[model samples]
Target chain A: MKIALLGGTGNLGEGLALRWGKLGYEIIVGSRKLEKAEKLASDYLKKVGDASIIGMRNEDAAETCDVAVFTIPWEFAFDTAEMLKRQLAGKVVISPLVPMKKVGDNFVYVRPEEGSAAEKLASVLEESSVVAAYHSIPARRFANLGEEFEWDVPICGDSGAKEVVVDLTEKISGLRALDAGGLSNAHLVESLTPLILNVMKRNKTGELGISFR
Target chain B: MKIALLGGTGNLGEGLALRWGKLGYEIIVGSRKLEKAEKLASDYLKKVGDASIIGMRNEDAAETCDVAVFTIPWEFAFDTAEMLKRQLAGKVVISPLVPMKKVGDNFVYVRPEEGSAAEKLASVLEESSVVAAYHSIPARRFANLGEEFEWDVPICGDSGAKEVVVDLTEKISGLRALDAGGLSNAHLVESLTPLILNVMKRNKTGELGISFR
Candidate 1:
């Protein structure tokens, strides 16, 4: 299956592109600028020696991919979705955005007016199947291709769309996909990011990831 | 140190009472009715064959115990704290309450107007040092004394009182305590309950608990 990583110049997008590209899935690195996307995609292709990966503008990438995963910062998340709404219709869209603000040295979750990032995306792109997943995993861990991810990835959305995302999640080795009910529960999942960040900050630990036991 | 389990007739309250009682802490099972508290405490004592556990009214429990853990439902949390305001002063209080509502077979996190359960509890009992912990653990698992708990317990509160709660958390065998920053960040901790519950319900899994690795 083909996957498009929106905002693919960033750490999370780069990580997903590398791992998924290595696993033989066609990866499209989506960005605002075609030049930047092409550069990153070319770099990834050179590293993995895989020519199937390509780079394109966000709109074109969304139009062509089976799944579009948004790894952009919270501020740009909605706008990006809004701009690509025409292309994203009737497609599976994944949101891993966590709305947060830095207070002093710590980060606190800022619940969006729509309750969560995924809910907001669901509202803006009514025609798309929005699934909330991969929000709690640290970008550093996901980007580290050599490291095995042994964490539970809880997915929430409409049943049919959620099954597709779950299948995608399981295809990535060591990621156990869990069905966490429907899209309304995305706030709880998004809230986990700040909690995990706090734990990492206070404990002085590196790359804190969660597992369900 | 003496620990009080307010609303001790409930599953979570009873579980903490059992575990701490067996670990040789003076466990005060507090309830609205002294008789109910006494009955539960007596039952716990009979099972553990220990005389350190006792039962008392909520007011008396808060007054005498070094730390008071509120295991009551979200609706009664603020009122209970407000009613026992005088007794809870100058004591370490722990809140494991998650503000959530069940909507059509799934649970959604309802952020209180005060932001989180800990924040609301702090507002109600301004003199008490409120710490939030133990929110993500399954009540059934904690109640079953035979099963060993292997999970990370993240705690957040003022430095001095948080240390006391952290010390207590680590006293339980197989449980590791990690500092999760200040009490203002407690909402993130409280929010984990509904997320874990959703995963457990949708997957038909038995008693899910979180671990940070």
Candidate 2:
């Protein structure tokens, strides 16, 4: 299936694109600027060696893909989702968005009034199937193909899109996808990001991923 | 150190009492009823074997101990903390309380107006050193002496009490203590309890605890 990474030029986007691209999925990297999208797409393609990957403006990519992953920075993601609503309608969308901020020496989850970042994205993309996953994956190490690690990705959503995203996540070696609960429970999964970030930053444990053991 | 477990009649209290009692700390199991406290203390002492473990009323335990752990249910813990405020003044207190509720099939964190359960506890016992830790430990499995497991406990606090709790947590076999910033950041750590509970219940994975690997 065609998968689009909306605002796919960041660390998280790079990780997902590289992992899925190498697995032979048709990966489309979407960005506000087409040139940046194309640049990162080609960079990821070179890293993957041989893969069906391309780059396009967010609107075009959103319209073309069967599935889309919002890998955008949480602050700007809502507006971008709003703009892409028509294009993403009736399609499966993955939300890895974490609304968090650094307060004093720690990172805190800025819970949206809509409950969580995923729920907010779902509200914006009303017709799209929004599934929350991949929140606590340490992107730097995940994007490094040479690094091997075992981590759990807790997923939450209301529809079949959750299963689709879970299957997509498990296709990436060394990652286990767990169905956490439904859309209303998305805040629990979303909060794990800031919790992981604060733990990593305070402990100086350099990009840690979670395991439910 | 004289360590007291306030409202120490639960699975979490049993786990801490057994673990720390074995470590040779003077373990005080406190409850509203002296008989209930004494009964559980004797049970824990039998399990721990030849260790310093005793039982007392919550008031006496708070006044007598150097450090106290609030293993009480979050709903009633505030009033208990208020009642014990004078007794616990100038002592280190650990808040393992999680304010949460099950919404349909999943658990959600009930964020207090004070930010988190730990923060709320801190607000109540203004003179006590409040440290947040052990929210996600699988208490049932933890209390089962035969059940061996590895887990990470992220701690948050504003003073030297954090170090004391960290040292105390790490002393438990198969557990690693991680500093996850200050007391202001405790909500991030507190939310993980419901996150883990939801994941475990929805996935039917039995009881699971977190490990940041």
Candidate 3:
């Protein structure tokens, strides 16, 4: 399937592009900067040996792709998703943003009154199906391509889009995709990040990961 | 004021004992093993020259001190607080525990249904004024005597006992104690740890801290 990663120049964006590109899916690395996006596309192509990868401005990427995934920061998720409303209609738009506030040695999830970043994105893109996935997982670990994903990746969204996200999640080599209810239940899952950080700090272990028993 | 730390041999406990002791508060280092606590007490005496330092087992430490702080793991917070309840009434008991679940190069906060670790303690100790503070801040940053605390420490509790806990917070050099409302709001403050870890992991910054605007 064809996927355009809006704001795909980010750490999480770049990682997802590489991951899916390897699985024979068409990937267009979208950016606000056309030249930068094209350059990243070429760079990723060189690394992954996937010549079909392309680069385009976000609007063009959205228009041309079957689905679009947003890997933007919490602050930009709503605005960016709103801009693509027309183009993203009848298409799946995935958001993996988590609202965070920095505290000493750790961060806390600053919950938006409407709920989590995914819910916020869905609100902005009312015309599109917004599937929330990959908010709690760290992008760096997924980017490594060397590390194993031995845990469940919770996917939550409307019924029509839920299976699509679960399928996307399963495409990753080692990840197990689990249904964590619908999109409204995001706050509970998104809130898990801060709890994990506290455990890592207290245990004094540099390498930390989650496994749902 | 005389303060006893029931688990003073460890990192968080030792740090708190030193911070309070440096401010002319008599400190008692208490542990499961009297010998270890005594060794820790002497070490503190040598470093800061606080003459009133004493070492004892957990119960004895609670019996002799005017106030006590639990600087142990979340699992131990309940049992230890229960054991010290008889000795802690009519005296201040502080808890500083953050619950986290480990994930690869990351951590997530596992907020108890009672809300936070501090709220959990307060529920167990109805007689003792179990005030929740210091759950969000990193102990290592506060452990450095040379460093300055130009940050806010969110202190939450029963309004009647707020002053005493705020006073304890203010005594710790430069920390400004901000009333973070009631214990129910503890989840918002406690949820910061994992979000910080995600930022650290993504940015590759070893030392990161939060500053409220």
Candidate 4:
């Protein structure tokens, strides 16, 4: 299956691209600018030594790929979804956006008016199936290709979309995919990012991730 | 140290009482009625075969014990704090309360007006140090004494009280306590309860606990 990483120039997108590329899935790096996406795709290909990964504009990538994953920051998530509404119809879209604000060296979770980023994205792209996952994994862990990801990725969505996302999650080595209820529970999943960040900050640790046992 | 479990008639309180009582801490089972507290204390003692665990009214327990832990439900938490404010003065108090409401088959985290349960309790008992921990542990895991708790408990509070709670947390076998920033970040910790509950519900699993690595 072809997977498109929307806003794929960031660390999160690059990391996922590398991992998925190594797993033999076709990867398309999507960004607002085609040149930046191409550059990151080139860098990821070099890192993973895979020549099959390609890069394109966000709209074009979403229109062509089977799965479109939003690895963008929370602030731009809704707007990007709105812009790509026409292209993402009938395709599975994933959200890893977490809304948080830094307050005096402490990060606080800011609940969006739509409850969560995933819920908002779902509303914007009414024809598309939106699944929320990968919200809790640290970006650094994703970028470090050598490290095994021993963390649970909780996914929430409608049944059909959720199954697809769960299947995709299991394809990644050392990661477990758990079905964590429906789309409404996305806030609970998104909120974990700041909580893990707080844990990492106070404990003086890096790449903090969670496992449910 | 003499540790008091306020509202000790509940499952969470009973579990902690058994664990700490086994560890040789003086356990006081506190409740609204002294008789109920006494009965639970007797049952606990019988279960653990420890005679030192005692029962008392909530106010008396707070006044006498070194640490007062509010293991009550979120609905009764604020009122109970108000009733015991004078007795809890200058003492270290722990809030494991998670504010959540069940909607349909799933539970959603409802943030209190004061941001989190711990922050609300802190505001009510201004003279006491409020520490929030153990928000994510499942009650069944705690009550089943045979199982070793291989989970990370993230704690948040002022420096002094936080250290005391961390020390107490380490006393439990196979449990690791890590500082999770200050009291302002309590919402992040409290919010994890419902997320775990949702995960358990969707996955058809039990005793789902988190470990950060």
* For model 3 chain B, the run of ten residues with the poorest summed lDDT: B204-213
Q: Report the C-alpha lDDT of model 1 over A171-192, residue by residue, as the tens digit.
A: 8787889998788788888888
Best-fitting candidate, scored by lDDT: 2
So what's the TM-score on candidate 4? 0.96
Leading candidate by DockQ: 2
Off by over 4 Å in 2: none
lDDT of 3 by residue, B1-213 (tens): 888888877766767777788778888998989999999899877766745687999999988887788877778878988888888877777777778776654466677888788888887777777666776565666666665655546665665676788888787766666665556556755654554444445445553334322
Fnat per model, in the order shown: 0.96, 0.96, 0.01, 0.91
* Candidate 1 docking quality: incorrect, acceptable, medium or high: high
lDDT of 2 by residue, A128-188 (tens): 9999999989999998999999999999999988999989999999999998889888888
> Against the true structure, what is model 4's DockQ?
0.83
lDDT (0 to 1) per candidate:
0.87, 0.92, 0.73, 0.89
Candidate 3, TM-score vs. the true structure? Answer: 0.56
Tens-place lDDT digits, model 4, residues A107-210 = 88888788888888999999999999998877777788988769899999975999999998998888899998898889888888888888888778887878
Clashing pairs in 1: none
Residues B152-175, model 1: lDDT tens digits: 888988759999989988988878
Better of 3 and 4 by lDDT: 4
Models 1 onward score TM values of 0.95, 0.98, 0.56, 0.96
DockQ of each: 0.84, 0.85, 0.04, 0.83
lDDT of 4 at B40: 90
Please state the error at residue B193 of candidate 3 in Å: 17
Q: TM-score-based ranking, best first?
A: 2, 4, 1, 3
**Per-residue C-alpha lDDT of model 3 across residues A1-213, encoded as one tens digit per residue:** 889988888767877888899988899989988999999999888878854789999999999998899877778867877788898888898877778876665566788878777888888888888887776566677666667666456666866787888898888877766665567656656765654554445335443444332
Q: Sort by DockQ, best first: what order?
A: 2, 1, 4, 3
